[model samples]
Target: MNLFDYTRADTLGAAVGAEGALLAGGTNLLDLMKIGVATPSRLVDVTRLPLTRIEEHEGGGLRIGAMVRNADLARHPQVLARFPAVAEALLSGASAQLRNAASTGGNVMQSTRCPYFMDPLSPCNRREPGTGCSAIGGETRNHAILGWTTGCIATHPSDLCVALAAFDAVVEIAGPSGTREVPMATFHPLPDANGVAPALAAGEIITHIRLPDPGGMARHARYVKLRERTSFAFAIVSAAAGVEVAQGRIVNARLALGGVAARPWRCLDAEAALLGQPPTEDAFARAAEQALEAAAPSGDNAAKIVLARRIAVRALSLAAAGTPDRMPALPASVFEGDVHG
Candidate 1:
């Protein structure tokens, strides 16, 4: 790694005021630096800033600090009780060691895990805007199937982001111009005409993530990630779903998909289809079809269209069943109390 000046900031103002890349957990940033994908002359360490708490919001919601570790938030009583989908999503991500070091802000801001984007010799539009995209026709098995431009077909690899989108979370940002609140749906924008993915502006720093109360849907939420392996693998297709059902009929529903879009893909059409309908296999199948209606799969990734639909139907079925025993299992090692409580 290249030599860089390092400074730890104890306050948000100091952290945002400093130049160069901001470091929180260094799980993704340091890895990118080592691979020559990211290089900074200086590193502003924001891990010590007072943003590590998970507290209750004023209106029965929850506020999670940017520095709050993934493992901590996943097991917190408030998160587990109020937003089980969030907890499940975090647990479904990287291994226990990684989860202990990853932070809420860093997790959401992580870059795509595309091989071409990480390879210096490869032509990746995300790495070098006008260089052209390698994933468009080369090794596209794991690339995006929705909201992709010809310049780039990369997908965001964040499990927590998909869950947050389903919950309609809000992001709090602090910068030189002061503070602003951005909805989670709008926080991670799709690639623009230039093919560059959206990112925090010049001096913006993530402060907190606010999750609205799920009300009755709190007890009926699920996050299902279908990866190549049962552990320590990125999702090939994943679904996060929450629904409020009354008298065997859905009242309110929220659905978001991952691993198939440039950003977390919220399915408003699917949610609308589920409302007032019975939560049956046929209903879930129709909702899943509605969700994937806009999918534009490439040659190698055409299988993902079917896989994403089946995963969505399964996730919705599990959420409607309300059976904890039937929920997907975490890794056996994670149960050792090392990462999760």
Candidate 2:
């Protein structure tokens, strides 16, 4: 806790304007600051702003305010019943206490959990604009494979965000320019032309997230994660799936993966494979295979290629069958798995 000026903002406009840095739950930002990962001169507290709400949209979508706690969102009966994948991903991450404090907006805006990016002494382009990224050559076992550039290899680490991508949720941003919505896939950008960092600009704040209400897919959805530990750890690979089934055939399907790319990795090719196909293990496996068609795993993370595929297939299979696996007990030990057919 370094000495920093703090302001409590009561409105979105006030909060976005009064910021040196915006603090919601202070879960990610404060942690980064404590370890010298983030050192801002000022802090604007947005948690007090009336942004915490979860309501049904008129067009069958769900509007989630930025300040809504992760625990609250995960436990919301409507969310659990309708968008179980979203709730599952939220509950599967962190601990109950941390979830109670973490907000949907903060979680969406959370930084990548790259070790080099977090270490001040480490050479990371994201942390230092001109400094070279050591992760590209150094310890990159857990780094990104898809959407990675020669300059950076960090992977995004939000399970909730990955699910949001699958749901095609849009982030509601409020800043000096009023409020606008950006699709969740576009909300978090890949390492820019500079090759070392994300693309979020200054003065912009994520005010809320809007998820399209599940139609038939609400009946079948799941989120699965594989981590070093059950609780309080980032994912090695995770999957979120929403399957809409009619009779024995699949109608609509979506899939997203975390800890596998620069942002929430959507498997468009995999998704295309499931359209109009029978809801079977073979179909799910093919979809998973198509999803990883262009994957480029790095260093010790080569195993992620297999694990990502398996998780994707399993998640889709469960969703298609309308039966998800029970959440494993924590602290969960990681297991070695394969993805090849």
Q: Name the candidate that leads on lDDT.
A: 1
The residue ranges of model 1 lying beyond 4 angstroms of the native Cα positions read 323-341
List runs of model 2 lying over 4 Å from the truth: 196-199, 323-341
Q: What is the lDDT of candidate 1?
A: 0.87
**Compared with the true structure, what per-residue lDDT tens digits does model 2 show for residues 1-341?**
57899887877768775658888888899999999989998998887777776777766888888888887777665676678889889988999989978888888888888888889898777887668777766777778867877667888889999999998898887767677778887677787545544444578788778888888888688898998888788998999998998877888999998998879998888888899999888899898888888888656677888898899988988787774443432221111111000
Against the unseen true structure, what C-alpha lDDT does each candidate score?
0.87, 0.81
Report residue 9 deviation for candidate 2 (angstroms): 0.9
Considering only N, C-alpha and C atoms within 3 Å, which residue pairs clash in candidate 1?
none
lDDT of 1 by residue, 1-341 (tens): 78899888898889885798989889999999998888899999998888877777877899888988898888777677778999999999999999999999999999999898999789888878888888777898999988888888888999999999999999999989889999887687777656875568887899999999998878789999999999998899999999889998999998999999778899999999998999899999999999999898754899999999999999899888772632343444443342322
What is the alpha-carbon lDDT of model 2 when measured against the actual structure?
A: 0.81
